[model samples]
Target: MSDSVTSVEAPEIVVPEGVRLEPERLLDLYWYMLLNRRLEERLVNLYRQGKVIGGVYRSLGQEAESVGTAYALEARDYVSPLIRNLGSILVKGAEPVDILKQYMAKGTGPSRGKDLNIHFGDLSKGFIGPVSMLGDMIPVMAGVALGNRMQGKDSVCLVYIGDGGFSTGASHEGWNFICAQRLPVILVAEDNCYAYSTPTDRQMGNRNMVDRAVGYGCAGVQVDGNDVLRCWHAASEAVSRARSGGGPTLIEVKTYRRKGHAEHDDQRYVPPGELDTWEAKDPVARYERWLLSEEIVDRSQLDQIENRVRAKLDAAVDEAEKAPMPEARTALDGVWSTPRWTAEHPNFHDFAAEIGS
Candidate 1:
């Protein structure tokens, strides 16, 4: 979009030390990243058609970080993603049709039309829904890790926060508590160049976010967020350390937010050449190039993956479009204590039957 765009050289893919991913796992990462991109594209179309109930927040150029990091976690680990980390949700086993239905506010969606966008999560799938209050999820995820420790489980929690969100008092407080208790949690701070219209320089005095990790008494590392392999490597090491009783690790993923804050925003605040610069480092395309160059996947294989992603998204969109909206009477169903709640949590509401009698 800039008049004087500079040609940026793509970085070489160097696999990190002490981390290894099989060819099958590499292809899986590509699948999830492609799925994330295609799904968001479909949502954008639905939004333009006036079908989406809320704004579309895309992770367009940052797919690698989301997919790669979440892929590193085991099934027992918990991930609390932010709005732009939809790729992580897909990696954590969320269905594309369910995400489409949620955006369309269909009754069949995860939240049963009570919420919109990536606002619903399945705890059984090891992911917590994004909190609108930004850094509030830090403390919440710390609690999750604490609960796992209390239950004598080896599970850890990975919580994502933007560079701007990391400056919040809540984030500082939560990190302090996590450090104090030596909780098993991984904090991913996405340095996506800008926060809304404000640049990172204006948001905080310390440009390097990972440096704050030392003040909090934890391990920290910064990685190129556009590199899928690097993201996976960094996250894997952190997960391993946390699972082995090591305290928290702060991972600062250097990336860029190519899209606007939401579909409605024009992103006029961005510098003239900034978008063009980041476009050259597009995560999905870069990863595909690396996969091909390294002989990990053939051109036909990449094409097939793209085709599969498109077909799956097409089906999800069609199914979600035909789904019904929530009925008015069901609005108050989960608003208060009910038989359904008691039935779902018998131990927590043991007096429900007595009250009914």
Candidate 2:
């Protein structure tokens, strides 16, 4: 994983029809995927070197789950990324330099160094920063969708959660609320087969997460999480239906976590041969091979694109490294806001004065 991105193309790979993207768009997708992989690898190195300010999480084998669903979204659509959805964040208008800065806790990061390690979001880009709790973002996402509905906008919100989060009280509460309201939301279960070290078998009695959707009366579809095009198609349909008058959709993407839960996790609980099996299905490599064999891109062109991405990421790291730290006094900023009740209740001012004392 420390080595640079590989351009090795798998033999005998064929993409199913209708989901094939144009050559230029396919190249862009590859660029974004490569960027994410490289950036995460760099983060791991930084973590090992004790430079990263906090725990580092990598998308690793699940790039397609994020990139594909994000690719299906429009500029006006909303996304809430979990810890492992770096590809989705990058695709949703977050600059690599900004992300690196965030991890490095630089003053110039999205949170202005108020937080560390992927805890920031830019709502202007239609991305909601994730909450620390595993499944809390689901309800927040539903609220965003409800707001879109109230405004009569066609925007739909896509939120990602892990398999472990599937059983969480917040997950159930959020999904139930979204379903009951018929909100414009797409719930993506990135079933990586494990919640931390615990396998899905130990976590839930129902292995089929999409079937849980039937209870909510929303459309549910499962896909080959490693197949970027398939994931994209499923997400596209869900997004389209949600944007229209139709309702929410629950998409289950079956994938595996090739690494531990985070940089700190050693993953001793994983059984032998499991990693190898999922590694063979590496989505980025599969997409690269399909693009090469189908003549969508030649070897040299793909190499050039990768080289460009490598250079860009290197420059981003350098820029982030040079950024200054945030001033201590700045911590007081952005943590508080005026509450509606302050203006609504005349006696609230007296209560505020009493607390101030």
Candidate 1 deviant stretches above 4 angstroms: 1-10, 336-357
- Top model by TM-score, which number? 1
lDDT of 2 by residue, 183-210 (tens): 9899999879889899998888887788
Worst 10 residues of 1 by lDDT: 1-10
Q: Compared with the true structure, what per-residue lDDT tens digits does model 1 show for residues 163-271?
A: 8899898899998899889899999999998899899999999987888887889888888888888889888988988988888888888889999999998998987
Backbone atom clashes (below 3 Å) for every candidate: 0, 0
- Pairs that clash in candidate 1: none
At residue 357, candidate 2 shows an lDDT of 44
